[model samples]
Every structure is written in structure tokens, then in C-alpha cells.
Target: MPWAHAGYADADALAWFAHCEQVRADGSGHEFGIFDAASGTLVGGCGLNQFNTVNGFYNLGYWVRESWQRRGAASAAVQALSRFAFDELRLGRVEIVVAEDNAPSLAVAERAGALRECLARNRLKLNGRFANAFVLSLVPGAPNTIGGPLSPNTALT
Candidate 1:
């Protein structure tokens, strides 16, 4: 996650993999390797994690590699994940915390119709100093579920 997001850690990585295993074992957490449907090459990645089954809340996060930023890859992946979250997982809410400066990422979240809720100032401790972050979400409504295979997709926007 550090390579894709930021920061690095020892136990965090281990714990994360372990979490992935646990979630996958029960058929919950998902890690999707993004690919170019045209070229069949692994272009990047996307998935939903930190899932909370009982409360029906989880996190949505992903990276599309530096090379595959535009092209609507992130939007496609997020739409798929969000559909899974709402349709399959039956989740009511999904949240995404994005670094404020990451316009590409923010754009991805926005394109997915996630609302910007707040400016979390000095909220994330990245390198000893707190970094500002944007709290965005897919809370059952917005516009632009415009590009994916989401069932009743038109009803959303």
C-alpha cells in the first residue's frame, strides 16, 4: 500500500496481507488486478478492503499505476467495486480517504460520484507531520454512475 499510497511499514504490511487472506477466505475483501480489456495486460490494480460486514461499511482504495492514470481505468474499476459493495456485499456505505493533492485520485473518486464530505486537516500522519486529506464517499447517491455495468445504473445518477 505504501508503494501505491505512501509511507512504509513492517507489521502493517504483514497484517494487511493477513487481513486479505482472512477476508478472501470468507469471500469478503477483494484485490483485483486491473487490466487493459483491449491489450490483456496488467495495467494496474483496484479493490475494496477494510470491510466491516456487520455495519455494512468498508473502504474503497486503489492505484492505476503512473502509466495508466487517464483512460477512465480508475473509474471503471471503482464502478465495479462499488457495484460489488452495494449489490453483492449489500453494503450501505463505503468511504474513501484521499490525499488532497492527488487530483487524479480525487478525480477518480469524484467520477465515481463519491461526495466530498470534509477537509481532514492534519489528519494523516505520513512522515511525522500531518498531511491534509479529503474524505469522499459513495453513500447511495450522487450523479455519474454513468460508465459502468452497474445494475439500475441509471437510477443512481
Candidate 2:
């Protein structure tokens, strides 16, 4: 969770969660925690955020626990969230923006069927500084299917 908590203090994290709850209640977007079904353990989180109403798309993000890395947890959660974005939310597209150097996250986006669009310059403000990011996208099509367990992962914004 270092990436997710990089710039935030405890209070900031708390405020972010509070805002997420409010957004969910208002139907602006959705946030979900990923869990292990058998053990009922929290592993990660995934969500649809940063709604672009004019473009009809949502930003998708997720991160797995250290122990859960390479276990397909993030991919599963992403697929579920993407499905929700297209089906329940009726959104046309979902974007996953990750730091260009973050290979693990880039792989997760690829596994979830996201297409790499471009490397945007100074696209994200991480911790305190700006960083480049790869903007991957998932649009409604024959290949963008959601069929996996619902789980959680760290998000970019």
C-alpha cells in the first residue's frame, strides 16, 4: 500500500475513505474492498473514480497486498469493476492510469484486457512530485468481459 499512502497522512487517508463513502452513497461512483472469500481477509481494493461525464468514462484503479502480488487478485477485481462500469454504471469506457515505471501495475492492466493508449507527460502527481503515466483503456467490446471474483487493489487517484 506504499504507493497508495505515499503522500498521505493518517488523516488524509481517513478523509479519502470518507469521501469515497459519500461518493458511493450519492451514486457518483463506486468503491469496493477486495477480500479472500474463504478466509475473509482483506487483500486489496478496486474502484471507479474520476468520472468524466462528458466523455462517459471512469478511471479504474487497484492494488494488491504485498502477500497477494502475482496471485491474480488485482486482475480479478479489475475485471469485476470494469464490468460494473459498463453494465451497472452504463459507462462507455474505463481508464487505468499507472506510473510508467510501475511494471507490476502495468501488467495487471494488461491482464485485465486494457489497451495501452499512450504515455502522458506529468500526468500524475504522486507523493509530492509529478510523474509520467501510461494511460490504458478498456472499452465496451467483444473482448472486454467481466468474469472474476470481486476484490480490492490500490488505486492511482
Candidate 3:
């Protein structure tokens, strides 16, 4: 994933975790690791970040490990995260921006029931270069049924 860090060092992981904590602490966003329910293995990560506070929306992002790709992992994560955003965070909108060439993420967004909003020009930075992106969005009370609604006390466990 272009959005992922290039290194795999322990220090890098620690820094990433610390950053996640800071994000949560500052009320900017929250990030979570995606784990396989049956095996309890880390498969990917997802988050709600880049708050547009005035607009009552957040940017939803996710990535799945290569082995877990094509098996509904990304879609499931998107559904759960969006539900959490809506129900728990009380946010009014969630946006998924996928690079124009990133077919996998675009598919995940569509399958998760996010409506495509636009093809934003130069909307993404990938490997130090800019790229156009497709913007998709999810709103409250939409027809999305995957994973159902998250309960009041429930989180992405």
C-alpha cells in the first residue's frame, strides 16, 4: 500500500503506534489494526482521520495484507469503521478516496456501499507524485447492510 510506511523496523512500528495515540489524544482521529477474527492475526489497518469538523465528516482509510486481499477483509473493515464513525463518533459523513489506478481499493469502497462522489483531480499523493482519485462517501441511514450497524457498546473487535 502506498500509504503504508516503507520500513518494517520495531522502532517504526512503535512510532506509528505512538502517532496513533497522539491522534486519538488530540481528537484528530483514531486508528485500529485489522485482525482476523478466527486466527487473531494482524491482516491490515484502518482508520477515521482528517476530520472536517465544520462539515461533520471524516476521512476513512484502510489497507489489507496481500494474503487477505480479495477475501472481503477490506470491505468488512470499511463497514465496521464507518459504522463506528456514524454511531459512536456521531459523524455525519465518511469519505473514501482511492487513487484512480487503485482498482482494489475502489472496489472495496463500492462494495462497502459508499457512493462515488467524484473524480477528484490530483487528490492523492503516491510515492512522492500526485494522482487523481475517485471520491466515495457514506452517509447515515444509507442502504449499506454489510456487517450491519454497530451497537452502542460495540467497537471493531
Candidate 4:
């Protein structure tokens, strides 16, 4: 539904839902949601979008509630998700394009060991304006993790 608010409205979340199902059927995209363990709230989502199973590549993006910033929640979830992609899913790579000005998110990406590839100009449209972006990725052995749920107390800020 968030994708609807972001622009794919007429088809509703059904479009994205179908997309997820198709990818899961064929070995590409997979959607995931982040939750707060203690509070039991849907904090945000993270997923593989615009994916290619043969190439083992997908766009990784995540959003945590504004209230949850700096808690290491994003990094932890990404760590688990990345591991799942590489190990269980046998992915060769997972790429993420993040807004350059989002320092905290960039830090989280770095902490998760995603390598910065480039600074993309006006890559994402937000509030009707295109913003500069940073491209990063985690390939096999990059972060070299094994999938699991977020362990907040063990996370880094």
C-alpha cells in the first residue's frame, strides 16, 4: 500500500502483491517487514525489488519509523536479510540505492558492509523532487552473514 502512496495507485497494492508472488514463484523478489520486538509494532519494511534471479541482483531498500532512528534496527534487519539472500536464496548480490543526505541510513549500510559504488545524480523522486542518490551493494562474502532475526542489544549504532 505504501507503494500506492508512492505512485502505483490505480492497481493498488495488488500490483506489488502480485509482483511479490511472481518473484517468489520464480526465485527473485521477496518482501520483508521489520518489527519492534518489545513493542510489537510494524516498524518498517525491507525487500528485494526490481530483481533478476539469474543475475542474483535486486534493489534493497528499507524504511524504519521516524521514531526508531539511531537504534541499529535497520542494520540488524538488513544483516539478517542479506544473509538470507546470499545463503538460503543463493543470491550473488544485493544492491541498494540510498539518498546521499540520509547520513544515518548510509552509516547503517556501511556498518552492514555494503560497498559504495557511486553517487547517482537525481536518482529518486521524493515529494515531487528528484534527489541525489548513493549506490551500494553487498555481494557474496562482503558481509558474509547467516540469516536470523534482529538482535538489537547486539547491534551497533
| Top candidate, metric lDDT | 3
Task: Give lDDT tens digits, candidate 2, residues 1-157.
Answer: 4446567688886886898889899777788888877677777878888888788888998877788788778888788888788888877789999998999999889888898989999999887889999999998765655555544433222
Report the C-alpha lDDT of model 1 over 1-157, residue by residue, as the tens digit.
Answer: 3555566577766776687678878776787667776566666666777777677688888776677667767777778788878778777788888887878889889877888889899756775667899988886544644344632211111
List RMSD in Å for every model shown.
6.1, 4.1, 3.3, 4.8
Please report, in order, the local distance difference test score of every candidate based on alpha carbons.
0.72, 0.81, 0.82, 0.74
The sequence of per-residue lDDT tens digits that candidate 3 reaches over residues 1-157 is 6445566688878998999999999878889988776667887889999988788788999987888778777777888888788879988789999999989899989988999989999999888999999999998887753456532322254
Evaluated against the true structure, the overall lDDT of model 3 is: 0.82
Query: In model 3, what lDDT does residue 35 have?
Result: 78
TM-score of 3: 0.89
| Clashing pairs counted in every model | 0, 10, 0, 0
What candidate 2 gets wrong by more than 4 Å, as runs, is 1-17, 142-157
Q: Supply the TM-score for candidate 2.
A: 0.83
Q: Which residue ranges in model 1 land beyond 4 Å of their true spot?
A: 4-19, 26-28, 127-129, 141-147, 150-157
lDDT of 2: 0.81
For model 3, which pairs clash?
Answer: none
lDDT of 3 at 113: 92
Alpha-carbon shift of residue 127 in model 3 (angstroms): 0.9
lDDT of 4 by residue, 40-79 (tens): 6767677777786566588877778777767777887788
Clashes of 1: 0
lDDT, candidate 1, at 92: 78
